[model samples]
Every structure is written in structure tokens, then in C-alpha cells.
Target: MKVYEALAAAFVEEGTTDVFGMMGDANMFWMNALAQRGVRQYEVRHEGSGLGMADGWARAAGRPGVVTTTSGPGVSQLATSMLVASRARTPLVAFCGETAWGDQTAAQYLDQGRFAAAIECGFVHLSRGDLAEEVVQKAFYLARTESRPIMLSAPMDIQQHEYEDNGPYVPSTQLIDRPRLLPDPSRIERARDIVAASKHVVIIAGRGARGSDAGEQILRLQKRTGAMLATTLQAKNWLYGDTDYHVGISGLFGSRVAMELLQEADCVIAVGASLNSYTTEHGYLFPEAKYIQIDTAPNLVMGNGAVADCYIQADANTGLAELTASLERESVTIEGFHTQEVRRRLTAPLIDPSEFRSQPDLLDPREAIVVLDAELPPELDLVLGSGHQTDFGTMLFQRSREITSNYGMFGAIGQAPLITIGSIVASGRPAFVVEGDASFLMHLSEFETAVRYGIPILVVVMNDQALGAEYHKSRAKGLDVDLAVIPTPELGRVAQSLGGDGATVRTTDELRAALAEYVRQPRPTVIDVRITRDVLSVPYRRLWFGEDV
Candidate 1:
């Protein structure tokens, strides 16, 4: 068997059924083997988008996701998004192909490892023989253990080189223990003290609070202390449907009541949330409230503006249990008169209208999302990739089910559609990707992959033909904004060529009809809504700078 063949099989053993990438000659052999092994390869339009898609998949799935790109420009293309995945600590292994060792004198040769290392990624070179299996094992280990990005560079010779075939190479099953929950008892007492003393207390859950058994503990603590609960967008659904005290989401696009409650609270306990600049309004999100921070990672405490009265480096669940026992010792009621009222405000339906007027040339993605949400079947799962549309979907697409996203520091655009495609296939549920036109174009070819896989996915492209968010910033920076504007083929035509339905809607009625028809078809489809270039829906810049919109 060839090294490429073994790598492909190893990836399959690692629970990867799909890989995202752009094909190039350097890695053509492995790509072919990956296809033959029944591991579907999603061909993206850009290398950056391929890495972005992998990062999104890992973040949503809570496992390592994979992507590949070939030598020279192909490998370089992945730099931006790979850095994003690395910083966000999304587990991803980008199998980048490098120029043949003999071609060291070639002009196309670039130091891919140097770049990846600078970004804090685990960079490995499979530039030698007899190290393929070890490299693969280390790659997976670094990816899962570090909870960070890892890049494996396979030179052309190594990729195609023949290796002695063993009967079956079963990978080692040993993995490091998952992050544990260890609570500090003294800190727990402090939390109990605050809960017992305050007439009104609020619990704000952040991304750090996710996936740990601690979520249930928080719920119990809420019930015990009569504390109202709110979650950051990243932590949405950490608490299941409609508990009496669950406040939906808080921040720039959050409900007025959510903002007001944070304002009114005397004691604010932040769990796992970094309470970064935007979430804190650069210090105004909770100006008057005393802070209590609980996280497993101590470094996060100092970074997210937590001048904690009590900081606990404990498992959120154990921490909560300790706090609960302490509260019981202090005779604090786990239930409250206002807890139900807080839940009522949180569960209240959002009635915010699209802020921008939709002109004939441009459409507001929020309005487009509203129309699509109304038209699509109510039961579908919605996962948005990061971009301008993520901001739009956070506000507009209100579904009862959980909305998952990769809000990691990577902030890569053009990866959402492919991620949705994989997620829909994996989850066996219809999925929707709310993406911007520029981001849509970034991985537009993946529509064909979605079509080939026979998965039903609805990709709503907020097609303004511009990098709406970045262009605005570029214009403000006095850069030539025109360079950011991309004139591309009509997205509908591209969709049609891929054997999928495509519709470009200029109005709400057309959008509704198109979405309804696409839903009925039960196939991959793209709904490109022409939004105005001047239309700004979420006031992203205003929110970023903590400006009153």
C-alpha cells in the first residue's frame, strides 16, 4: 500500500467520513484513495474555505475534522483559516501537500511549517519514510489532546511512496482523559454567600461552560438559588428547552430584557464565558454588578475582564454542586418569586424587525432569513458559519432547536455551507447554512458535493456580491473598497450546473416562494437574495465599538 492509502484509512479509523479540500497534483493519489475508500471529499472553491469548513465541523461535532490542500499556493491558501482554527482551539488536521524534496530549488517552494508554527499550530513534516503511522498517530493525538489545530505536511514523494503492507493497521484506542471537573470548596462557599446575600442574582453562561456535566449543575444551582440564567450565543442550548429561568442569548443582538437584567443585577456570576470586549460592551455589559468567574482554564479569567470577587478553577458541574450544598447550608431558597418572571422575559418571542430598508438591488440578509425561516419546515437544524450572515442569523433566524456555530477566533468566511453539508449528512437532519455572498462564493463548489451526497441542505446566500462587513471597514480605513467587491457568476446558474435548484430573490414574496419550492424538492439548493451594498443589518461595527446603534 502507498503512504497515501494508509493515511486515508487511518483518517477513516479516526471517525472521519468526509474530508474538505481543493485538489492539486501533489496530493492527487491520496485524494483518489480517499474517494475509493468511501470517504467523501468536498471540493471547495478556495483553500481557505476548506480549512474553515473543517474547523466548523470540528467545533460543531466536538471532534477532530480534516481538510487537505496541495503544494505552494494551495497550502498557502489555507493559512488564514488554519490560524483561525488554531486560535479557536478547534481540533483540525490539515493535510497540506508540499513540493517534492528534489524541487527545493524551485521558485514555488515555501515554508508551510514555518507559517503554521508561528500561528501556534502543531506542525509536522512527513518528509521522511517509515514515519507515516507515527505521524498520523501524533497528528490525531495533538489534535484531540491540545484541543488545537495540527498541520501535517506530506511531500509529494512521501504521499506517493510505497510502504510495506501489513495485514491491518488498527490505530491505538488510548486517548487522554477528557477535561475533568474539580471544584474548589472554598470558592464554592463564596458563590453560595453571594447567592444567599443577593435578592436578585443572575447566572451568565459562556462558551467555556459547554459540554461539561457542569451544565446540569448550573441548572440545579439556578433552581436552588432562584437565579435567572442567560447564555452567550456560543453557549446557547447548554441548557435544554424552556427551563423557568433560561434567558435566551445576550449581547449586541440580544433581547432588551436580557441587557436590562444584566444592568439591574447586583451579583453576576459568569460561567465559562470569557466576557470579552464585545460581550461586556468593553466594560458596560455589567458595569454595576460584582463578578464571580468559574472556569477550568485560569488564563481565560484575566483576559475576559473578570475582576472576580471569587475565581474558581473547577469543573463547572462540581463547582455548581459545591455551591448548591453551600447554599443549602445557608438556608437560601433554590426557588424565587422572580425566577419565573425572568424565564418569561427570556422565553418571550423576538419581534425585532429588519432594521434596513431593502432596496431593489440589495436585500437585507435578516429579512431574507426571516422569509426563509418562515418558509422552511420548522423542524430543520440550523448551523451558521461565521461571517456577516452569522450576525444576521443570530438576530433573525429564531428556531426552537439549538443553533450551532463556530464562533471561534478564526472568524473564517466561506466555510459554513460545506460544514452544513457535512452536519446534515452526519446528523441525518435537514440543515440550513446562512452565509454571505462573498463567503458563499468562497466555497460555492461544495454545493455540487452536497448534491452528490444526496443530502438536503438549504444554503441561503445573502448575495450582495461584496464582502459587506470588510468592505465597510475598508472604506472607513480609506482603502480602495472596490478591491473587496467581487463580481461573480449568478449563484443560481452555478447551482443549476450542479444539478440543484437555484433562485435569486429580489423581494420577500419571491424568497418565500423559492424557499418553499426548494423545500418541497428535498435536494441541495441555494437561495441567493440580492441584498443592497449599502444595507447594514446588525450594526456590526457599532456593536464592536460598543456604540449605541
Candidate 2:
């Protein structure tokens, strides 16, 4: 068998059924070989979009996403997406082609390993054709174990060499060990003591709490301790139905009531959460709270420099279950943070009551989100793009299931559309991508890709005719806001030109009509909701102007 064929076989053995890529000379042979073996291939307009799609699939499907790129510039275009995946801890394996072996003068020659290191991605070079299977297996193993992107580079020249058949390839699943770490008895006792002694308790869940029975376990613990519930932004709507004591998302994107309640927490038990700066509001969210962190790798000090009084190193489900059982054994049930006033606060309107001056023909972004949230199907996957509009979408849109993933981890915009396409392909569910006008136009070409692939993704563009974040910032700084205020084409008509459905709506009624039509006939569509740029999002207003509603 040829080396490229062997690599394809190895990928099949690793259970890689879907891949995203754009054709390039260096990697085309192997990509073709993989496709011949029944792997579904998604061709993208740009290499960066392909990587973003892979990242999205990894998050939605709960597996290591696969992507491919050619040598030199094709691989170089992956910098932004690679860094995003690395920082977000998304599992991905990139199959990239290096320049021809020993051909330093080749046009596409680049030190691929060094580039991978610069982006903080794990790298494995396929120097020998005979080791192709082993190299592929190792890349998968590293990506799975580390929860980060891994690059597998093979030289173009070596891919054509003859390879002998080693025995059947062994998949990485056999070698991967996912043990559930249990909490120590002494540490469990300490955590219990902290919870029992505190007057007000709050339990914060993060992405680590998903994919297990952790949600139920967390609820049981909350009920036992009378603790209020909240989730990190990444884990938004996790405890959605617990309305009495649940205060929604915590941190910068949190609502006023949620942040206020979090500030008053006397004891905070963070489950499967990293307690990062954004989640903890830069270490000021829970000033008086005795912090207790529970996770597989519980550290004394978190990313925000907040010290935990107790750290329990265990799986979220296992640790929370044990804690609940321990409390039951002691017959300990404390009326900590559960009060009549707190219940009323939790049930209050989530959006700020402070009203902004309304524009004649433009809708409020927050109100637009609320309308979309109420109209869109509850089962749809939501992907949020980063910009000034992110705060509105994150805080206003509420859903029951916690299947949402944000493209704002790296604070980059214009990735939500590609990510949403991948998510639709993975989950086989309709999706909505909430993006700013500038962000949506970043990869408007991908709308054609979506049309070609027939992916059902509805992009809701919050059209404010500017780079919302920069525009707001420039105005606040008394700078030339015109630089950020670039006029955009009618996005709805643009989507139509790309072979997808489109609609431009300037009011809530028009927005509702567009959404209802899309729901009735699901397809690739874009609803450009014209929103006023004057009203600032709550988080942005607070952070930029020190004003709170």
C-alpha cells in the first residue's frame, strides 16, 4: 500500500468519520485517499474556516475533530483557529502536509513543527513512511488526553513511497484511560464543614459539569444545602429550570441580579469550574465567599488569583454525589441562601429595567434577542460570536439544554457562521448563529459553502452598521468613531446572492415573521435584524463607562 493510503487506513481505525478541509497540492492525495475510504469530507472556502469547523464539530460531537491543510500558506492560515482551539481546550487533530523532504528550496517549505509550537499545538512529524500508522495513533492519543489540538505533519514526497503492511492498526481508544478520580475522605469532610458553617452558599458549575450525571448530582447537593445555583458563561443555561434559587450565568456576561447575588455569597462551591477571571469577575464576584473548588485537577489558586479554602480533586459527578451522600449521613440540611427575597430576585426580569432612547426604525439588541429566544425552536443549537452584541445574546437568550458554545473564547469575531455549520453537521440539528454585522461579513463567502453543502444554519445578524465593539470604544474614548463605522451591504440580499435565503427586518414584528418562516421551512438563511447602535449592552456599558442599570 502507498503511504498516503496507510495514513487513511489509520484514520479510519481511529474512528474518524468526518473531516473538514480545503484542497491543496501537498495534502490533496491523502485527502482523496481518505475520502475513498468512505470518510465524509467537507470542503471549505478558506483553510481557517475549515479549522473553525473542526473545532465546532469537536465541541458539539464530543470527539476529536479532524481537519486537513496543505503545506506553507495553507497551514499558516490556521494560526487564529489553532490558537482558539488550543486556548479553549477543544480536542482536534489536524492532518497537514509539510514541504517535500530535504527540499529546502521548495516554494512551500516551512518549519511546520516550529509553527505548531508557536501556536501551542502538539506536533508529531511523520519522518518515516513505515511509521505513518503509529504517528497518526500518537497524534490522536495526545489530542484526546490533553484536550488540545495536535498537528500531524507528513512530507509530500514521503506520502508517495511504498509501505509494507504492518498488522492491523490499533485505535487510540484502547490505549486511552479515562478514570474517574474520587475525592479523598479527609478532603470531603473539610468541604462539608465549610458548607455547613457558611450562612449563604452558591454553587457554580462550568463546562466540566456537562456530559455526565453531574447536573443531577449538583441539583441534589443544592437542595441539600439550600445553595443557590449559577453557571459559568461556557456553561450557560446549565441549570435553567431551577428558577427558585438559580441565578443564571455568573461573571461579566451575567445579569445584574445574578452578579449582585454572587457578590453576597458567603460560601461558593465551584464544581468542575476553573474560576477564571471572567467567571469570577476578576476576583471580585465573591469577595466574602469561602471558595471551594471541585474538579479533576483542583488547584489551591485559580487563574484569577482567587485562593480556594478547600480543593477536592475528583470528577464533578463523583465528587458532588459523595458530598451529597456525606451530608445525608450527617442529616445536615442548612437554609443557607434560599430565602423569600432571593426567590423573588431570581424570578425577576433578567434584562435591565433601565430603558434607552429608541430609534425610529431600529430595534433594541436585547429585545431582539428576547424575541429570537422566544420564537426560535428550543432544540436549536446556539453559537454566539464575539462583539458588543455578545453580552446581549449571552444574557438575554435562555434555553433549557446547555448545548450552546461561544466563539468568543479568543475574543475573535466572524467565526460563528463556520462553527455553526460544523455544529449542524455534527448534531444534525438546526442552529442559530448570533453575530454582529462586521463579524458576519468576515466570512460571508462561507455562506456559499453552506449552500453547497446544504447545511441548515440560520445566521441572525445583529446589524448595527459598524464594528460594534470598536465603535462603542471609540465613542467612549472621544476618538474618531468613523473608523469603526463602516457601512455594510444589505446582508439579507447578500445571503440570497450566495444561494441561501435572506431577510432584512427593522422591527420586532418583522423579526418574528422572518424567524417563523425559517422555522416552518428550515434551510440556510440569514435574518439581518437592524438594531440601534445607540443602546449599549449591560456588560459593555458597565465595563466601558462604569454605569450599571
TM-score of each candidate structure, all chains considered together:
0.86, 0.97
How would you encode candidate 2's per-residue C-alpha lDDT over 1-549 as one tens digit per residue?
999999999999998888998888889999889989999999998998999999999988988999999999989999988988898898999999988988889998889999999988999999999999999999999999999999999999899999999797899989988887989989899998888888888999988887554888988999899898998888888768754688888788888888788887898899888888888888888888888889887465775675788899899988998888988998889887788988887777776535534488898888898889899887787888888987788888876754565635688788888788888888888888998898888888888988998998899999989988999999989999889887888889999999999999988899999999999988999999888888888888888899877
How well does candidate 2 match the true structure, expressed as C-alpha RMSD? 1.4
lDDT per residue (tens digit) for residues 279-306 in model 1: 6666676666677778877646433445
Off by over 4 Å in 2: 298-300, 352-357
lDDT of 1: 0.73
**For model 2, what is the alpha-carbon lDDT of residue 347?**
76
Worst 10-residue stretch by lDDT in candidate 1?
539-548
Error of 1 at 281 (Å): 1.4
> All candidates' lDDT scores?
0.73, 0.87
lDDT of 2 at 112: 93
